[model samples]
Target: MKILVPLKRVADPDNANKVKVNAGKIETTGLEWKPNPFDEYAVETALRLTENGANPKARLGEVVVVTFGPKETESTLRQALATGADKAIRIDATDDQLDGDVVARALKALVEKEKPDVVLAGKQAVDGDSNQVGQLLAEYLGWPQATFAGSIKSEDDKSLLVGREVDGGTINVRVGLPAVVSVDLRIVAPTSVSSKHSPAHKYPEGVRFAALMAIMAAKKKPLTEMKLADLVSDAALKITYTGFELPPARKAGIKVASVPELVEKLKSEAKVL
Candidate 1:
């Protein structure tokens, strides 16, 4: 199985408190960059699917990571490579040139060229939170898709059994090969990705840390660069960022001396009752 995973770089989610709104856009200066958390789960899913149990260093198939961004984004791809992806591809494009639709179109082009058996990506990127690219890419390719997959297993060489997260409970479905899957948080669980060599084998929860050796080896891994314009043209963005504003701050809470006073405050000042 040749699996393709899309990686994205986003401002560190942990430092969300530091993010600020500027005149009409988000101010990201001095903020750290890291792979989208959900996308990291996608990468871990792909790596687990291709891992060979008999030999830790050997893989049954390839896991290729792709991303669309400027030169700096290559660091993100390198991180995925360090985690065991076979190779990396960076689509040269600026942040201004990319939106959900443009990204979907570019990925569609890569899908056609690579002919991967499966395309796994995050359910959404934290930065935009659009949650549209994977479905759009599947539509653009005329391929089946399973979104918000919590658990996944190869039903056979040509199909996958996916456990999807819904409102009330999980729904299991079988999707054919050459499909697209957008993963959610549970996908990073130890036993989420089934292994062919050992059906019961479990990976450690969360994305694996790249060892010093692996980090050094990643430098030797093949990373191919492609021009976004060459792959897909007419990528006119369908949406534009008009402006940004911080949500209204919360008011301070008041303390009440007793239940009656609290009820009076609720019915009068608060007016809830």
Candidate 2:
């Protein structure tokens, strides 16, 4: 099965506390970039789907990763390539020049060009937290979609039975080939994926790390760059960011001298008797 996975490079989530808001926009200076955690999960899912459970090193089919950003974002694609992706495509665009709709439209065009059996991505980008691209892309392509997939089992490379995580509980749905799937956090679990070529086996939890050899080899792998305009004519952003600002700081907590004092504070000061 051929899979096209879309990835994004976002400010390192670990140092999110260091993020600052100025002039209604986030400060990108001195910020580190890393693959979105959820997108990383999607990459792992694609890798697992392409290979058998026992011999994962052998690529049964192709797994291509794509991203939208400037030249620096090539590093993000490289990282995915290092892990297991066969090829990488970097859309020449900046964060400010695009939105979810434009991204979906561009992806739709790219998918048509690549003609992959599946287009997979994270449910949302951590920086924006707007989970819209996958659904929008599915809508534009007029393909079946299964979102929030926690587990997936490939059946003869023709269809995938997906276990989706919902509010009440998990729901199972089967989508035909040439579909779109947005995965959830649980997707990286040891037993989250099952390929038709491989017997039942458990993979390590979380995204797999690249070996030194693989890391170096990734540089030699194919990396393609496409202009944002080449893929989509209407690059006009549908969504605009006016500004960003940090939330107000909260007051430090105080220790209560006794239970009665705590009760008093809760009743009056806290206003929750």
Candidate 3:
């Protein structure tokens, strides 16, 4: 089974306080770049699905990682390679040149070319927080989709049983092969992904770290580069960011001595009552 995992580079979520807006665009200066947390989970899920057994050294199939960003984004792809992805493909495009729709279109084109059995992506990118690409891509490809997947099990070579998180409880659904799975946080858990080869084996919690040898090995792995326009000639962004303004500063909290006082404050000052 061939799995395609789409990744994105984002400002270090840990340093979100350092992010700033300038001239209507996000300023990257003084910020660190890292793979989107959810995308890392997607990569981990793909790796787990393709793993041979509890043995970390055995791989049953290929995991191909792809991304859309500028030259610097190669670092992100390299990281995925270090995590045991067989190959890396970088789509040359600037941050401003692409949006959710354009990315979905570009991925659709790639899917047609690569013909992977499964496409796994994060439920959303933290930077934009617009959870639209996976659904849009599934629509473009006319394939079944499982979104916000918390757990995934390969029922066979041709189907998957996906556990999805809903408002009240989790719902399980079966999807055929050649489908799209957008993963959520729980998908990174030890037993989140299972297959015939390793049905009962458990992976370590969180994304696996690459050993020094794997890091060096990734340097020799195939890394293909392509222009975004070459893949989707008429790609156009359907949304525009006019400007950005920081949210209002939070106000300090006040203490109420009793329930009646709290109700009085809610009615008089907070005005929620």
Candidate 4:
């Protein structure tokens, strides 16, 4: 079974974030980039499945890691490759403005070319936090979508039994081949960087430019592009971006010295029962 894993580069959650003012647009720059934590789980899950020597699916073919980002995204791909992927595919966009529709479009194009048995990605990307790409991609491909999968085990050579996290609890699901799965972080723990699997360090200084070239080069590396028309035989889903607004800053709360004072404040001022 050929598996395709999609990864996204997002702001490292460990750092402080500041919005940048760029020609009236808020630019998220100067922040460090890392894989969406949930996508990392997907990658690790793919590796685990492929490494299951005792299972027949363990003999599954290549593990391909795909990403769409600025050239800096190559580092993320290399990280996946170092971790365990057999190969990598990088899609270069003019800019990092890919929304769920565009992402699904691009991935749909790629999937048509690769025709993998399974596709996996994170439930959401930290930067956009839209949590819609995987579902959209599945829709575009006319594939079964098992979303928010916390754990996946091969039920048979052509089937997967998945543990899906839900609002109240978890649900068990079974899906056949050629399905899309959006993974949760608890699905798999990522492999740490080690000497045996260190990412490519010698990247160019201008990563965006380099990444564009690398995407062009990706055509030679088992990559293919699909046109917008080919992506949707019917009316394509309407996708648009309207305006951006910053949320109001949260107010700081006063610290009370004792539980009694806190109770008094809650009862008298905050008006809680």
Candidate 5:
């Protein structure tokens, strides 16, 4: 089983306060970048699916990680290699040039070349939260898709039983090979993923950390760079940002004199009643 996982780097979500709107665009200057958290979980999910938890170093299958960004994003791919991914691909492009549709188009091209049995992705990227790529890729490739996967059990190399979390309760779907799966946070839980190679094993609670030796080795692993134009003939963006603005500041609370005043405030000021 060969699995492809797409990763992305985003501004540190913790420092969202630093985000500024200048003119009609969000500023990206001097902001710290970290791997999108949900994408990292997807990477973790792929690793678990490809190896036995007891013998993680001896992979039963191949795991490839890919990303789209400038040269600096190579660091993100390297980090994934340090985790356990066997190879990495960095699509050379800037954030301004790509959106959900463009990404799906490019990935479809790459998928043709790589021919992996499965594509695993995060349900959404932290930066945009679009949650469109996986479904779009599946549609473009004419493959079955399962989103928000909380658990995955490999029925074999050819099929998967996926558990998804929806509004009211959980739903399970079985998808054949060559499918796309978008995973949710709980997908990283200890028992959330299992494969035929790792039957009846309870993995540790979360993604595994690389040892110092493995980190050093990751620097030497293969990371290929590909031109975005080479993958897709037309790299047009369907979504455009017209303007950006900071959300309105919260107002301080005030004590009302009586129940009537509270009711009046709700009716007139709050506008709920």
Candidate 6:
């Protein structure tokens, strides 16, 4: 089966965060970029599904990785490729514009063109903490969606058995071919640098092109783009920023010599147990 996985670029978790004022709006800056942690889980899930000769009933075909971000995001795809993705496609665009709706629309276009049997994405992106894109893309394609999937298995050669982690327990659901699955961290662990599989090299020139041309060329590689005008539900989501405030600075706490003094301070001034 042809599998499609959408990856995301997010702020490196180890870096300190800062807000930049762009036209009176707060924009995140001063941070290094890394693949969203959840997407790594999704990718690992996909890889695990095909590994160990698990899908022997029907030979697993290929894993295609897709991502939407600035040109630098290709590095994230390279990481995925090293991790075992058969090939990679990147939609070169400004990192800020990759919202739920825009990314869903773009992915819908790509899915229509590629016609993959399964599409996988992270439960949410860490940078925006928005979990809407996978569901939105599934809605756009009129495909069944399973979110926060804990485990995915092939029911037969034609259907997918998906396990979703719910509040109290897990729910088992099945979807026919050509469905979307968003994975939670419980699905799998992040792929390390060494476990990556090397992909066969394709034409370098077509692979490395300018941003504008790269997007144009992405259309040729099993991608289709649709405007909100063409969607039925127009259910694509938008994030609105209203205001921003800096967190209040914290004051240093005084050290106490004994447990009694700490208890007294907490009871009198701090008002804690």
TM-score of 2: 0.95
Candidates in order, TM-scores: namely 0.93, 0.95, 0.93, 0.77, 0.92, 0.71
Candidate 4: how large is its RMSD? 8.2
Error of 1 at 103 (Å): 0.6
Q: Which scores better on lDDT, 1 or 2?
A: 2
Tens digits of per-residue lDDT for model 3 on 143-213?
99999999999976589999999899999999999999999999988888899877987777899989999
Cα RMSD, each candidate: 2.0, 1.6, 2.1, 8.2, 2.8, 8.4
Order the candidates by lDDT, highest first: 2, 5, 3, 1, 4, 6
* Model 2 accuracy (lDDT, Cα): 0.93
What are the per-residue Cα lDDT tens digits for candidate 5 across 31-126? 899998889999999999999988899988999999999998999999999999999999999988999999999999999999999999999998
Candidate with maximal TM-score = 2
lDDT of each: 0.89, 0.93, 0.90, 0.68, 0.93, 0.68
Prediction 5 TM-score vs. true: 0.92
| Residue-wise C-alpha lDDT for candidate 1, range 102-127, written one tens digit per residue | 99999999989998999999999988
lDDT of 2 by residue, 148-238 (tens): 9999999899999999999999999999988999999999999988888764779889999999999999999999999999999997989
The superposed Cα distance between candidate 1 and the true structure at residue 269, in angstroms, equals: 5.2
lDDT for position 1 in model 1? 88
lDDT of 1: 0.89
Worst 10 residues of 2 by lDDT: 192-201
Worst 10 residues of 6 by lDDT: 192-201
Worst 10 contiguous positions by lDDT, candidate 4: 192-201
- Residue runs of model 4 more than 4 Å from their true location after superposition: 16-24, 53-60, 189-242
Could you give candidate 4's per-residue lDDT for residues 194-258 as a string of tens digits? 11112212211211112454444443444333233444344334555555666676888899999
Model 5 global lDDT (CA atoms, 0 to 1):
0.93
